[model samples]
Target: MAGSTLDESVTAFLKNHASNDAFEETDPVKASQKLFPEIAYTDTEKAELSQWLITASHVGSNTEDAAKAAERLSTLNTHLSSRTTLLGAKPSVADIALYQHLASVVSKWSAEERTGEQGYHHIVRHIDFVQNSPLFGLKLDEKVHIDADNVVFKIKPIDAKAEKERKKKEKEAAAAGAVASGATPTTLTGDQGAEGKKSKKDKVKDKAQAAGDAVASTVVGKPGAPEGAPTKKKEKKEKQPKPQKAAPVEKPLSPSLIDLRVGHILKATTHPNADSLYVSTIACGDPPGTDNTSEFEGQVVRTVCSGLNGLIPLEEMQNRKIVTVCNLKPVTMRGVKSCAMVLAASPRVAEGEDSHKGPVELVNPPADSKAGDRVYFEGWEGEPEGVLNPKKKVWETIQPGFTTTDALEVGFDVEAVPQLSGEGAEKKTGVGKLKTAAGLCSVSTLKGATVR
Candidate 1:
């Protein structure tokens, strides 16, 4: 029969509660609820479980009430297990039927130990006794018969020897099949045999090969091509130009002490009192290091004073480490104060793939630019000029053009200026400096000056 038809008997048991005289019939839930109402439901539970009753009334067709019936039956089973007295001094078939109602009705929590094996074992014990009993309509043998008195009785004989022989034959047949196919035999049942395993292995290999081809294409420019093989079509070679003089070999630049460690923003929330201000907590440190822990101490907590406001979502900043100016003075915004400024890329295109344009491009790496690192300009050897704001702990500009507004407008104009390194005739425009006139610019860093 279909699974729904099998549940008809269980559904009829729950429907008895809606009748005027429920106790006149053998009602499983009513009996269990009266025997143990405290265990039936809790004080926190609502008394108006009529919706559930209506749902259980038409359960076979009602999808919504099907879930409720299953839950109620499962709870009844738990109560039956904990309180042994409900089954009386000798466990009766009625108790077993009550427990089965829970297992068959409640479909949720199917995998849970309390409702699965434990519940099954207890019900099976009662089924065994009822099957052995000679009581009319009580005994469960194999074929159920109703006598002239309209009484039910069953006759089922245990067949241990036949069950064992059938299982043994199944095992041997599986082993012989494995040998004939030249595959390793496994006693594990279901879809865990060599044929199933081989299919899974082939699937995994195909997936891996596809992934490798994709990676190879990214590096070599074509699928199945050797690594580093150029993908683009080559153009005809042109004659090379020679220089009059050769430049000196450049020295390798050293890593900045401060930039060695990285900091990530942990949380960001707008400042309660300030409209333009944001309160941010950041964590900095080298990922786990040597036993000393001080190397990681380069990791420190710092706050960011950002104008991003609504431009960048707070969640976007989490775990991101942009450059942070650690040695700056704290400034008060509205009423709350900010510790340092966060270094970020200039406003460019946003992130994502739905744009009419292709993938969003990253800002090009400057000819000699390293982000998050301090830049020091070439200067005469002497004390640098600048007033240090103790409250701010930052060096204020003494030279002609160095203000917040000037810094903000630095990228607008580009102009040529005399080389600061004393290269007599050669003139190069400061690549990343504020151009004040047709041929003048100021750099992010001062020439040999210390701030903070």
Candidate 2:
């Protein structure tokens, strides 16, 4: 019988039966007989469907294995093309099983790979037919359209009821915890009273205090003396004076937690999907020092995606030595994956003026410094984070430290020029000087610019 007719018959038979013990069968044979008691298949047809299921399971084992399985399925599909089903003319268990297997495998294949010159048209047809049949239990709205081949296929639908229940349970658990802690349970939207409100800084402080309390509990025993017994006062030890040791010198503050390196742009191109972005391949040299086992130690070609399309002309990008954040996580801009970020400084636009027309200059490296060389402030020495998580606010904290001076020295040192009161009197007090490692990344041009 046709799949629609079979579905109708199964529905009608199930509707007519109302026995509570009908689903109590536990044995595999008994369960199968109870569920599909009327549907019967020949031994040869059953064997063929079993073979197809076994073959489909091995589809993605490896390239060779997948190709072999595809070839077998293609041949089988070709043979069954003239028939409505895998066996004879009517849809059967064999047809359903084989169609399901094909559908499962097809979802994994890319649109181009699914319908190429050597594609299995018959398998695709069979999948489309089975998915549209009443027995599939899939709605038309659930089908996704593949633009490349103009084929519509059903994707796995999410269980909305289960998801809702999971979220509800989570909310209940949070509410319970809040009640236990003597705090009012607030809605997920956080529209609590002003008395319960906490700023971001306040929240961070609370978290830090909680962490400190946990650490203190681990280190020292719980508060108060052990049960009973009067507490004895301990005598303090006498202080002894010894030879004074040299005071430890304070280290300079680093401008950023980012691993800024000198890199030479090897290739630059406008991003196909975004007009404001430029995709460039940069060559950053290996890590400094010997015996380094870091994977990034050797010469690395990092793909950098930047929004300097309008600011920097395409021709000027070639062989340009630019400062790059070498340790940033790879991000996909448009369709291309970028592994690094180029550094540039642009002056802040005046209240009434546009900043785009202002001169945006790239931070220049020292003439002696080569690609891959680490850029450090004058007094600090340490490695940058391998990869910075923006969520941690590391970049946000150090961004203000990067600035230029009137003298055009492009470094991290903040210099303050004092107004002259008198010739004899001291001119000004030096303040706000940024302390960086010995080496500084600089640019010859001194126009006021903001480093990004």
Candidate 3:
């Protein structure tokens, strides 16, 4: 029960018995109801039954009570055996019913020794016999804990409810202390409360210091005390302060070197063979979409070949613009080329599931600029391509009409450019309005607006 518990196996066995049709008519619940029709199927019956078993195993009065319970169990098992075709063969409903009763005693036999009854021993022996037989479909190693009182197996000292109660008590104690000292209780607000909650370890050290002060005061007699009240006091010892190490300083980057712009993904597709790898097409602006509409405004149609093949299907990435690392050099992976890096939110993986790792993004950026566009804090327009200086180019070839000439990255993260509200911006032509799941938006004429 304490380490590497085995209650899961027992639970699985019980659950199977409850659901299996083999126990349809001769189920324990049905049998108990039939025999004790006048007893009334109350909540008390279930609770009492559980208590009886636990009490009998832990501590029962003399041998008489133990014998009576053992006899009742034996009678129940005999009655069940009579109802089914085979006592341990054919795997009938009665066998399932008897098995649970037998397994319960086997699990509780450790503390049963306190009962000081041969009847308890007899019960365990019989359960062991049934379990050892292959026909019964039971195993002795299917251990169950009879002593686990705590349900949540916490591995840490932190418990939410316990912490809440402890804090409430501390607040009351602090208020009481302030009253005794004839001082106003300190009211923490804003920075004060924030500072007070800073270090629990420091709080403990302060409490120890207060205790030492009280002890030292008791050792020193007051000036008005009787002459017979002789006082002896020792010097207060100061706690030794440990030497502190200075933290290393981090190098600050020059503000002029920082780039700050938003880029979008132009295209997406999964690799045909690799579990990962998505090929894509990206446009800095002018992403492809359904038709020209203002609703599809401020989108990028850049291509991105990424490692998100299996996590997201290729068809789902079409015409969807995504943020990207606008400064990375385009590199060729698995024979497919990529231009700028496509940025996306990190993937979330649930327990017992595969990871969904993707790209990263900034909290906010300019609206019009998109994927493949470098975000610089301040820089010249028309920046050079391939920031990372990779060995080969990212793209294989530029295709016509925004279609995948070779294999598509086959995901969202790119689209056509939209109208800019700023002055001097040209009204780009050849693009059309596109309808999306979200609503109407602008799109590029080069590609049909296929929603991923």
Model 2 ranges with Cα > 4 A deviation? 1-253, 286-299, 350-357, 413-440
Query: What is candidate 1's CA lDDT for residue 86?
Result: 30
lDDT of 2 by residue, 184-264 (tens): 655234456552577768879988999999989866866666669699889999989998999955333344456777788
lDDT (0 to 1) per candidate: 0.36, 0.55, 0.38
Task: Kindly list the per-residue Cα lDDT of model 3 for residues 405-450, writing each as its tens digit.
Answer: 1121112222221211122445423322211112222222212222
Poorest 10 consecutive residues by lDDT, candidate 2: 288-297
Off by over 4 Å in 1: 1-261, 284-299, 347-452
Ranking by TM-score: 2, 1, 3
Q: TM-score for all predictions?
A: 0.24, 0.37, 0.22
* Cα error of candidate 1 at position 277, Å: 2.1
Model 2 TM-score, 2 decimals = 0.37
Model 2, residue pairs in steric clash:
285-372, 377-436, 377-437, 378-436, 378-437, 378-438, 379-436, 379-437, 380-437, 414-434
Compare candidates 1 and 3 on TM-score and give the better one: 1
Give the poorly placed runs of model 3, Cα more than 4 Å off.
1-261, 264-266, 285-303, 313-316, 347-386, 389-452
TM-score of 1: 0.24
Per-residue lDDT of model 1, residues 239-291, tens digit only:
78876697854322211111211235667788787665567775432112211
Worst 10 residues of 3 by lDDT: 397-406
